[model samples]
Target: MNALFPALRTRTDLPALRFGAETLTYEDLGRAAGALVTPILGAGRVAVWATPTAATAVGVVAALLAGVPAIPINPRTGERELAHILGDSMPGAVLAGADDVLPAGLADVPRIDVETAVDHHSPVSAASAFSGAEPDDPESPALIVYTSGTTGPPKGVVLSHRAIAASLDALEEAWAWTEDDVLVHALPLFHVHGLILGILGPLRRGGSVRHLGAFSVEGVARELGAGGGTMLFGVPTMYHRIADALGDDPALVRALGGARLLVSGSAALPVHDHERITAATGRTVIERYGMTETLMNTGVPVGSRPRPGSVGLPLRDVELRLVEEDGTELRAYDGESVGEIQVKGPNLFTAYLNRPDATAAAFDGDWFRTGDMAVREPDGYVRIVGRKATDLIKSGGYKIGAGEIENALLEHPAVLEAAVTGAPDPDLGERIVAWVVPADAEKPPTAGELADHVAGLLAPHKRPRTVHFLRALPRNDMGKLLKKALPEALHG
Candidate 1:
């Protein structure tokens, strides 16, 4: 509530960020961000060409300082999607890095090029000082983050400064995240995981961060080993790559094993990868649950051993509940019964920009309907089943979670990647189908053998009725499996 970041007013001389070969001290960042304020002042909303660079970070910070809403545009976004976002947000201006090439949609908007280097041999004044105001309004929208709309067109989710503050505070409390920890990752800067948590999270804590430009096993190993990174953040695909290479490279094993914390998000990290990483390095990767609307809801407490396929407990101040289809709450944490996730807390988004009907429908009373399915243990731990629409396979009078069968299939040594979906059937209502990428291409395991492996681990009914083999599963930029793309991928 006290201006979102108190560290900006007090901290200086700390290593603020390291991106590629560029380095910045806290003072440098303050000045660089402060310089940007005058150029983008009085803009109601601004668009950012969010490339994974120092300029993007500076632009976002500058927008926040000016108390203007910043909408981050993915660099690789298609022109069609870009056009829609531009038409929707109607930003007053667009900010991009010095060397960035923007799409045609942004040609009409005023453009401000970001400069990362600025001499600041002195401390920076409070951001509120520039506007001649006491402080920015906490409830005012700070960012308009977009969701991957599998249900419909992409919608802009407005996040207030208060929401961002609440989430980061809860995360700090839950992870014991201190200013002394140096965060490291190679995630894209457009998304919440990489933009807010990876970059801004460190800045808010008065800590430093190192970005690898792109993810590589070598980068992760080298950074943690000698780059002085203490905490690591990545998506499942990044971790999956590390897990796959851990046995061959002792450096990767030693790097992960020696790091203080390793957190995975953006998708479910396969249980097989978790066990493999832990087996080789003696370190357990932490999994946390969050969406674009909710910054972060739950995480495995820092020191606790992460349960396989579980996202652990709700974060501090986040009130979570599971609900039945009828909208009644499921109060018991019996661990076997599944329900849709409903949340009530300060971490909730303000609105889905310009969509009152969607925003109103998003909440049932004070709780936001998350559309995700999960089972909660008696101890309050959460095991995500899957999404209600895509993953909840109701077949033969049994509610089968595709995630469970996916996990079971991953346990088989021959299986590389597995995704499950339900197909309509005349007799059973829906039949469980498995799409897999085998570890061995020359001689892939038969569908019956994979199904048998699942049956042995779980119930027989949970096994896949049919199998489809592919070279790789379709995924978005953040590594989330695209279940809706399954039908199209099958024919491709």
Candidate 2:
């Protein structure tokens, strides 16, 4: 029930963060925050757009410490979507870099140029005024995160301090993180994966983190080989590229070997990539399940047997139930049935800001009915089938989760990324279709060959009936497959 920044400021001399060529101890960061807060007093909400660095992290912490809600908008979003979020959040001021593009309407707001803010000399002031007051009641909104809208326009999810605290505490307990641990931080700050798990989670536990402004396979491998960090969190795509870059470096191998844990999320990992990573790193990549709404629900246990292809059990204080198509709750002990996943826990977001209708529709009493389909194994492990109705491909009376076919397709040597959708067919009600990104354009696999490859690994009904090769697969801002957009793109 304590505000995070205020609590951390007490241990001012501890190593706080390392980014690029810069470093900031907790004391320096607290003072920097105090300086930033001085001019922005009474600003209820502040929007920030800065280069992903220690400065940006300090800015967010500074805003929180000042009792101002911080909204970190993605720099690459279209002006239209950017304007919508700004209008909705109604920020009192904006902190943006000179090079950052802003919506046309944003010029009217008070601006704090980030380029000049970070250049100020060491802040010479007491940090007490900036320390936020006692925990905003557990349900009071602390952060607003926008999820990529598959159903409609994006909506802001209001997360409370208690919700975030629950997630971090559960993560630390499940993974056994200690103050001595150092985390590698290269993921985007706009996403919960990086903002919460990558930064806040480690910081809350007194652990150190090294932040990377961007992800480059060669650059990241070099950092890992240097061996200062002990844990890595990345999306599946990032892991694939990093594994490929390591090739045969003994130092890279040793660094990966030394890490306490390597985590993957955002998208499901192809079993082929998973195998390659384990072979090269000697560490099984721990895949966890989460979304913008629920920070994190489950993860494969550290130092225990990692059940391959499963996301592992629910974290401490997380409760999960699987419901059948008939609206009946499926027994968790049943080994053969797959059902929709509904979760209720302290870590789940309270509601979508300004979207009371969505808040009402997303839940059933206390449980938030996550639109993900999963099956619980006899051993208490849960393997994701994929998203609920939207991602379920119906072809010739058989229902197949697109993720499964895509996962199988990725195992082929030539396939780089794959998206599966149902295409209109004359004979079948809906036909299985796949759009793929090939690693080698000069030697792309034929539709027949790719279909055969998938058929060899899957049942005839589950194999993709048609295939098309593309330069890249489409993904939303958060790196989730845009299945609804696929049918249009495929036919367009």
Best by TM-score: 1
- My TM-score estimates for the predictions, one after another, are 0.97, 0.91
Instruction: For candidate 2, write residues 214-310 as lDDT tens digits.
Output: 8766555555558478888888778877678667666667877778888888778777778887888778888899888999999888876756567
Residue clash pairs of candidate 2? 12-27
Which numbered prediction scores highest in lDDT against the true structure?
Answer: 1
Candidate 1 lDDT, 197-292, residue by residue in tens:
998899889888999998899999999987888999999899989988987998888888889899999888889889988899898999999988
Candidate 1: minimum summed lDDT over ten consecutive residues — where?
Answer: 125-134
Candidate 1 colliding pairs: none
Error of 1 at 93 (Å): 0.8
